[model samples]
Target: MDPTLAIPLLGGLSPAAFMRRHWQKKPCLIRQAIPGVKPPLSRTELFALAERDDVETRLMLQRQGAWELRHGPFTRRQIPALNQPGWTLLIQGLDLQVPAAHALLQQFRFVPEARLDDLMISYASDGGGVGAHLDSYDVFLLQVSGRRRWRVGPVKDATLVPDMPVKLLANFEPTEEWVLEPGDMLYLPPRWGHDGVAEGPDCMTCSIGFRTPTPTEMAREVLQRMIDALEAPEKEPHYRDPAQTATATPGLIPEALQTFTQKAVIAALNDSRSLACALGETLTEPKAIVWFEGGEALAPGQGLRLDMRSKMMYDADHVFINGESFRAAGRDARLMRQLADQRALSAQECAGLSPGARELVEEWALSGWMHGV
Candidate 1:
């Protein structure tokens, strides 16, 4: 949960130094980044999860120069035989379902929660791979089982093959190569081309991806939130001009109205509480394919911790859990911030919460987002 925990894994580099020098800037191949790192789920367990309709999964098969992709909620029989070659199965958000995977993800908490995505597990047969590709967001590739041969480079040509299900780079040129054994990890910044092929049977890799919102996407979300704020009845304030000269050019937008709009926008931006709420909610939203198992409310005085499956974040004035925001203040704000930072509220901290905050925590527990400390 702190910088000290990362020392052994990062070759004694302080967390601050790692963040400043290497994070999202270049690549680092750390041998045994996680000592004795094992796959969170066994092959049978992973296959069982893939059978559930709620789990997001995909199967890709390449044979005889032909590629085929299939969506899953697959039955056991649906899985191809292990003897088959050139096939891969991917399960998204494994961390959300497995405690060990969740614990693994917490090791990267130095990065902002907003940019942290989820763990994706890929199970591949011998010679299986998704092909050479570049992602727009940062990624950490950790080898969990068997062996994988990886080739990587700074891709000059980002062009994709004309008609393929995968966004494969047409001109992939490898400048570096490595064969990863269990516990090895490779971190790559955005737009770095990489390809990995299973060296033999039963190769599994865990990919931790970061969120990268484009400017246009961010602007759209912010503008929509602004419009929603403008429409709130209690906050609405109309433009008023007591003395106005009637202009011959009626098509011109009224100066008072324009000024009002500009002020409204600025006001929205300046509202720390609102901005915090929006950012937190957006970051914690469940993936489209994710759902939760509702449970009973917590008893009073019970401590709380985030469900390993849930995402929570906070800012100075608000806390976000599972894509919803709550206005927070006073000791509640401090406590919630601590929870966001550490992902848990200790028994002592829970005892200090106000009755109102305690009630909210109980509600979150019932929603399966928080658990007893």
Candidate 2:
């Protein structure tokens, strides 16, 4: 995707300009971002998806000043009829399960993959909503079906209503409002208070969320990666202090040992290849609810492509797929990196892959991570 291109999906503003001017800094409301855009799935189709055990779904119902939430592996009959009031069905990670949903998500490729999370679909009845709330992560709310009235603003007090199943804002202050129809989109930065109530029945919205990694979470992930990098004790370096005199309280952690440990941690972090590997692995990890179907191995000389469900990424020296890392080099490395970026390699491109690379692609195909082009 060309960031400088002014596409209809970005409402005539180049993605480059949008990112520099608005992303994470403020909100953007783009009308007809997807001209003539239609819902990828109908109400009946969504209900059918919710019935599958492999799909992750949630049901939320509001009635008489009360909120109810339930997990689902629901059946079609289990869902409330269209005439029902104040009920919602939410399906998470729709992109990982449906090809059309995955294709829809690809439109937002202007954003970095690290921040791009997944597409979540919300199907709601008249006056239905999770309630006024704020999210810690950025979100693009796209109206895919029916109409929804949204009131959004930056809240001063981010307090939640007590004893509520949903984390609803206690004091919502709406500075902007709009009723979004199909193809309309509203982008909200992190912590921006927003509330949406379905104007009528059969309202469906797709939220494209961005992952926001906290500092503590990043530290924990990096530390865990570093620990995993360390080999067995026999192969691992140990602290040495042959010249050190024994202190009276030798049981305490020695200053020399502390210094050594600090230096070791710094050294581990400073290793460019190790850090790159760790970050790549972390980014490519599949969500807990994700899974895949096995497939036949790729034929020799066949082109390669990633499963729409798989997440893959890479840096200069390493490639990451499904939370695993592999060292990459040469023209083959370039080809693999292209695959990560484009999500597929054409027949000609596959033919150009080296024997070793071809073997790897076949293995991925067999594992249901990639397919023959």
Candidate 3:
């Protein structure tokens, strides 16, 4: 997408303008991100998804000012009657399972895929809400059906209600409030306090969230990947200090060993290529619960598109997909990067890849990482 092109989804602001003015800086409420937008799934369909063991679902209700929360694979019988108020059901990762949801989410590609997370749908009955809370990542809340009222503001205190299963702000102070009808959307930055309550039954909201891994969390994953990539030799070198005389205090640490240890760590950390590979692979890693079904291998003339469950990314010298990394260069490297960017490659583009790269892609198709298009 052209950065300077004005988009209706961004409230008439071009992506460039929106990124400069509102992204992570403040909120922007778009009246009709998608005019006449309909929910990707009906209430019945959403409830059925919640019944699947592979789906991540949550049920929340407030009765007499007391809150209750439950994890799901819930039975239809377990769900409250439609007439019942004060209840909400949330289905996570809709884009991974639903074609319509995935297509809807594709519109937000202006944001880099590295930061992009999944789309979650929240269905709420009259007076239902999850309570006010702060999210650590940016979120775009789109009201797809029915009406909901949102109260949003900056977080003054990070305190949560004690003994609550869900994070509920103990004291929510709203400075901006709006009633969102179908097609309305709201954007909130990280740590911005917000709450939404269904105006009536059948209310459905879709949340597009972005991942914001903390430095320590990123370090742990990247470091682990880097360490795992080390190729250990069959024989290991042992530290020796045969020239040293016997010390009166054996407890004293040896300077030579400390220097060796430092050198070893520095050597490990200095592999810039390894570090880049580790980061790319880490970013493209799929969710723990995600798995793909095996399919036929890509034929010579067929184009290819990534499986919805597949995560693909590329760095300067490497391409990463589903937690695995491969060094890529030359013509094949350029085509692989194109696949990562476009999420698909034409038959002509696939034909351009070298023999080794073509074989690798065929393997991906057989493994269900990509499909013939």
Best by TM-score: 3
lDDT of 1 by residue, 1-373 (tens): 5764547556566678777777878887888877788898999999999998878899999989778889998998998999898999999989888898898888888788889888999999999999999999989899999899999999999988878888899999989999999988888889899999999999999999998999898777756664565446686656778888878999999988898889877977887766666667767888887777886676655667888878878776678888888888999999988988888988889998898988888888888888885
Q: What overall lDDT goes with each candidate model?
A: 0.85, 0.88, 0.92
| Per-model tally of clashing residue pairs | 0, 0, 0
Q: lDDT per residue, candidate 2, 20-49, as tens digits? A: 888889999999988777888888789999
Q: Write down the worst ten-residue block by lDDT for model 2.
A: 230-239
Query: Rank order by TM-score, top first?
Result: 3, 2, 1
* Lowest summed lDDT window (length 10), candidate 1: 3-12
Residue 309 in model 1: lDDT: 74
Model 2, residue 169: distance off in Å is 0.6
Best by lDDT: 3
Report the C-alpha displacement of residue 121, candidate 3, in angstroms: 0.7
Work out the TM-score per prediction.
0.90, 0.94, 0.96
Residue 8 local lDDT, model 2? 83
Which residue pairs clash within candidate 1? Answer: none
